[model samples]
Every structure is written in C-alpha cells, then in structure tokens.
Target: MDLVAINLIDGLFYGLLLFMLSAGLTLIFSMMGILNFAHASFYMLGAYFAYQISLYLGFWAGLLIAPPLVGVLGALIERYGLRRVHQFGHVPELVFTFGLAWLIEEVVKFIWGNNMMAYQEPEILKFALFHIGSNSIQAYKVFMIFTSMAIFIGLLFILTRTRIGLIIQAALSYPKTVEALGHNVPLIFMGVFGVGTALAGVAGVLAGPSLGTFPGMAVVLGSIVFVTIVIGGLGSLWGALIASLLIGWMTTAAASSSFQFATLLEFFGMTPPADLDESYLRDLWTLSLPQIGPILPYIFMILILVLRPYGLFGKRDA
Candidate 1:
C-alpha cells in the first residue's frame, strides 16, 4: 500500500511536469498549426537560464525571471526566424524548427559543457513533507504538484472564460475575420508562440533540480512530449492533463512493479524452454515490467494512434 501511494504521488508529479511542456506545444499547434519542434529546446533553455539566475538571485528569483526571458526569446524567434519561413509552408517551418532544436542543443553544450549543473531545489523545500513506510515525500515535490495544478487551472480559466481567449480561439479558424475586427492576427500568433515556449521554459525551471540541468535534457524528454500531446489529442487541454496523468501513473507503476513477462506467458498457457539461450522466446521470458517501463508510453501512444487517429480529445478538423 505504501509503495502504491508513493508511486501514485510520483506519477502525479511526473505527469504534471510533462503537462507543463506539452500544454505550450498543444497551444502552439492549435493556433499556428505549427508543431514547433524546438519546443523542448526552449524547455532546456529555461533550466539553464534558471540555473544561472539561481546562482546570482536564488531559485525563487530564477523561477520568476527565467521563464519571461525564454518567452521573450521565443517571441523574437517567432517575429524574426519563424515569421520569415512562414510564407514557405509547414515543411519549411518544421525544418527550421528542427534545425533550431539542434542549434540550441549545440549552444547549450558549448555554454554549459556536458556535465550536469549543480542545480537543486531551494533549501527551504529540502525537508520531507511526509513519509510512507521508508519512502519520504519531499516538500519540493508537493510544491511542484501545486504549482502545476495552479498553472492548469489558471490556463483553463483564461482560455475558456476570458475575452482574449475567445479572440485567440477565433483567430485560429478565422484569421481574416479576427484581423478585420482590429486584432493584430500576426501579433497574436507571435504572442501565442511566445507563451507556448514560455510554458516549456517554466517546465524546465521546475524540473531542473529534480531531473538535473544538463544539455541533453531536452532531447531526453522531447519525443515524449510529442507523444503526450498526441495521446491527449492535439489541441485539447483537458486531454493533455488526463493523458499526462495516465502516462505518469502507468510508467511509475510499471517501474515499481516486479511483474514479469514469463509470468504473463505462463498465465496464457505458454512455457519457456529450459535452454533459454537457444529458445526464440528467451528475451520475452527474461523480460520484466521494470525493464520495459520507460518504453510503456511509446507503446501506449501506438495503441492510441491505432485506435484513434485524431487522438483521445482531438477533433477531426484539428
């Protein structure tokens, strides 16, 4: 029971972290119809930026300052780099963003080197909030949970209840109509792109200490972020939240489980050969849930795509 509780909490934390990254990507895709392949790169930038800022001003200050900086950079990229390529269609946009991702990764390596930075959670949050059996739940994990939940609630309110939200949504389907109403449609695009990247930056800041601030951090989570948004349905915020939680819990539970493939095979009336090395099913016989935990999300993604091409919450038009 204690182990289950621990896994649940851990899964929730991880799910929210993925949501922070995926939300922005989802938003960008919904508005601009651009996937923004470099989204995770911005996430990496956030961590590195926070790490540097934390050195001078502390974690709280870094938390406040770093995301805005990343947002501004994203805005500039939209205004200059992405904007120039926008006229060329999505292929150009994708290629540009893909190259940009590589550029950002190289730049990070050049600036921060290949080692993990000394980034850590604030000292005030270092203590355990509580414990389950021998497992301790730190204050930092709780903080991250509340913080992510707050972000989700705040975004939901803004997108569904606010006038600006209506305008943003309208612009997606009727840009000319929105522009005719005196809204700077292009500016809206830039802002949405900026905001999306900024959300990624925020994820980086929060995850930096817990996951480690390293150059390869973006690459590590990049593909998974796409899987998250896809499984959640491309543009659905609620879908993102649900899928994130599902993945978080699934991966966490699998990692903590001792269940084996051999057991599963036996349950299905299959038996492994005594000379396992010569058997075709040797690998399957030796496999354990924990060994495949990391790839579970990908497996889940394939299933989701196979069953629902538009995703769980995505529209056919989307």
Candidate 2:
C-alpha cells in the first residue's frame, strides 16, 4: 500500500512535468502549423538561465525572470529566422529547426561544458511535506505539482474565457478576417510562438533542480515531448493532459512491479528449456517489467497509433 501511494504521487509529478513540456509544443504547432524541433533547446536554455540568475538573485527571481527572457528570444527567432524560412514551406522549416537544435546543443556545450550544474531546490522547499511508510514526500515535489496545475488552469481560462483567446483562435482559421478587423495576424503568430516557448521555459525552470541542469538535458526529454503530443492528438490540450498522465502512471507502475517473464511463461505452462545456457529464448525469459519500464510509453504510443491513427482526442483533420 505504501509503495502504491508513493508511485501514485511520483507518477502525478512526472505526468505534470511532461504536460508542461508538451503544452508549449502543442500550442506552437496548433497556431503556426510548425512542429518546432528546437523547442526543447529553449527548455535547456531556461534551466541554464535560471541557474545563472539563481547564483545572484536566488531561485525565486530566476523562476520569475528566466521564462520571459526565453519568451523574448523565441519571439525574435520567429520574427527573423522562422519567418524567413516559412516562405520556403514545411521541409525548409523542418531543416531550419533541426539545425537550430544542433546549434543550441553545441552552444550549450561550449558555454556550460558537459558537467551538470549544481542546481538545487530552494532551501524553503527542501524539507519533507509528508511521509508514507519510510518514504518522505518533499515539499518541492508538491510545489511543482501545484505550479503545473495552476498553469493548466490558467491556460484553460485564457483560451476559453477571454477576448484575446477568442481572437487568437479566430486568427487560426480566419487570418484575413482577423486582419480586416485591425488585428495584425503576423504579430499574433509571433506572440503565440513566444508564449509557447515561454511555457517550455517554465517547465525547464521547475525541472532543472530535480532532473539536473546539463547540456544533454534537452536531448533526454526531446523525443519524448513529440511522442506525448502525437499520442494525445496534435493540437488537443485535453489529449496532451490525458496522455501525459497515462504515460506517467504506466511507466511508474511498470517500474514498481516485480513481475518477471519467467513467471508468466511458467503460468502459461511453457517451461524454459533445460539447456538454458544455449536456449534461443533465454534472454526473453529473464526479462522483468522493471527492466523495460522506460520503453513502455513507446510501446503504448505504437498501440495508440495502430488503433487510432488520429490519436485519442485529435480531430481527423489534425
């Protein structure tokens, strides 16, 4: 029971972190029709930015300032780099972003080297908030959970209940119409892209201390971000949330499970060959759920794609 409780809380924390990372990518793709290959680089930037800022002004200030700074950088990139590439079509856009990702990684390695930064959570949040059996739940984990939940709620409210949200949504489908109404459609696109990247920045700010701040940090979570949005259905916020949580819980549960393939084979009355040393299926029989936990999400993604090509909540057109 204690193990179950621990896994549940840990899974929720991980799921929300994934959602924070994926939300920005989803927003950028939905608005600009561009799948940003360099989005995770911005996330990496946020962590480094926060780490540097925290050295002087402290973690709270870094949390407040790093995201906006990253957002401004994103807006500039859209204005100059992506905007020019947009005229050349999707392939060029893909190439541009892909190159940008590599460039950012190289830059990070040049600046920060390959070592992990000494980033740690604030002193205030370092203590345990609660305990389950012998395990303690740290306050920082709870803080991350609440912060992510607040972001989701704020985003939901903005997109559904505000005038700016209505304008942004309208611009997507009727750019010329929005332009006729005295709104700059291009500026709106720039703003959406900036905001999207800022969301990614926020994820990095929160995840840095917990996940480590390093040049390779972006690479660790980069492909997984795409997997999340694809499984949730492109441009579907609800789908992203659901998929993130599902993946979080699934991976956590699998890692906690002690079940082995050998046990399953035995249950099915398929005994391992006595000449186990040379048996073709020897390795297969030795596998355990925990050993394969990291790949569970990919497996789940494949299943989702096979059964529902459009994704769980994605529109057919999407």
Candidate 3:
C-alpha cells in the first residue's frame, strides 16, 4: 500500500511532465499540421538554457527566462526556417524538422559537452515536502506538480475563454474565411508553434534535474512524447492529458510491482525449463514487468490503434 501511494505520486509528477511537453506538440500539430520532430530538441535546449542561466541568476530566474527565450527562438524558426519549407509541403517540412533535431543535438553537444550538468534543485526546495509511510516526497516534485496544474488551467482558460483563442479556433476551422475576415492566420500559426515549443521548454526545465541534464536528454524523452500524443490522439489537448497520466501511472505501477510472468505461467501449468540457461524462452520466463515498463506505452499505443483506430478522444477524421 505504501509502495502504491508512493508510485501514484511519482506517476502524477511524471505525467505532468509528459502533459507539458505533449500539450505544446498538440497545439502546434492542430494549428499547423506538422509533427515537430524537433519538439523534444527544444526541450533539451530549455534544460541547457536554464542550467546556464541558473549559474548566474538562480533556479527561479532560469524558470522565468528560459521558456520565453525558447518561445522567441521557436517563433524565429517558424517565421524563417519552417515557413520557408511550408511551400514545399509536409514531407519537406518533416525532413526539415528532422534534420533540425539533429542540428540542435549537435549544437547542444558543442555548447554543453556530452555530459550531465549539475542542474540541482534550488536550495530552498531541496527538503522533503511530505512523506508516504517511509517514503519522502521532495518539495521540488510538489512544485513541479503545481506548476503543471497551473499551466493546464491557464491553457484551458486561454483556449476556451480568451479572444485570441477564439481567433485561433476560427483560424483552425476556416483559415481562408478567417483570413477573409481580416485575422492574420499565418501569424497565428507561427504563434501556436512558438507557444507549443515554449511549453516543451518549460517541461525540459522542470525535468532536467530529476531526469539528468545531458546532451542525449532529448533522445531519451523524444519518442515517449510522440507516443503520448498518439495515445492521447493527435491534436487533442484533453486526450493528451488523459493519455499522459495513464501512461505515467501504467509505467510507474509496472515498475513498482514485483510481479513476474513466470509466476503466472506456473498458474497456467507451464514449468520452468530444466536447461533455463540455454532455453530460447528463458528471458521471457524470467522477465518482470518493471524490466519492460518503458515499452508499456508502445504496447498500450498498439492496443489503442487496434481497438479505436483514432484515439480515446481523437476525432474520427483525425
């Protein structure tokens, strides 16, 4: 029970991280119809930028500055680099982003070197926030949870209530009509793209210390974020949130449990091979869910595809 409680809290924190990154990706994809291969690269950039800024100004300042800086950089990329490729259609745009992801990785290596930075939590937030039985919950994790919740609420409000959001929705549904009505649709696309990348940047800043701030950090989280959006349904914010939390809990629960397939196989009347060392199925018999927790998202993704085809909340057309 204590383990379950601990894993639940841990999973929530991790889920928020995934939501932050996926939310931005959803916005960009919904507005621009581009699967940003460089989205996680921007996340890596955020961590590196925050780490650098934190050296001079401290963690809070890094949190404040890094995301906006990333947003501006994203805006520039959309206006100049991506916009230029847009005329050539999605294949070229995808290739552009794909090559851009590699470029960002190389640039990150050049600037930060191929090492994990000392991106520690703030001194003020270093202590345990609370405990579940013998397990202590760190203040930093609580802060991250709060930050994500705030961002989620803010995003929801912006999309549902704000004038700009209405305009964005209008542009999405009727880009030609919206433009005919005098709204700047292309500018809206650029803005959405920038905001999306910036949100990923925020997640990067929060995750860096916990996950390790390294050059390959993007590679580590990149595919998972894609899987998150896919499982949640492409371009669906609520779906992203649901899928993120589900994946988070699923992975955490799997990792925390000690259940093994061999035990289940025994219940099904399968005996362990006497020559286990040489048996082709030895690893399968010995493997635990924890050992393969990371792959659970992919499994869940395939299951979703086979069943729903679109996603939990994805539109039938999507």
**Any runs in candidate 2 off by more than 4 Å, and if so which?**
none
lDDT of 2 by residue, 9-74 (tens): 999999999998888898788878899999999999999999999999999999999999999999
Q: Output candidate 1 Cα RMSD.
A: 0.9
- Colliding pairs, model 1: none
Candidate 3, residues 193-225, lDDT tens digits: the string is 989999999999999989999989999999999
Candidate 3 minimal-lDDT segment of 10 residues: 165-174
**lDDT, candidate 3, residue 54?**
99
Candidate 1 residues 33-72, lDDT tens each? Answer: 8888899999999999999999999999999999999999
Cα error, candidate 2, residue 214 (Å):
1.0
Residue-level lDDT for 202 in candidate 3: 98
Error of 3 at 87 (Å): 0.7
- Full ranking by lDDT: 1, 3, 2
Task: Tell me which of candidates 1 and 2 scores higher on TM-score.
Answer: 1
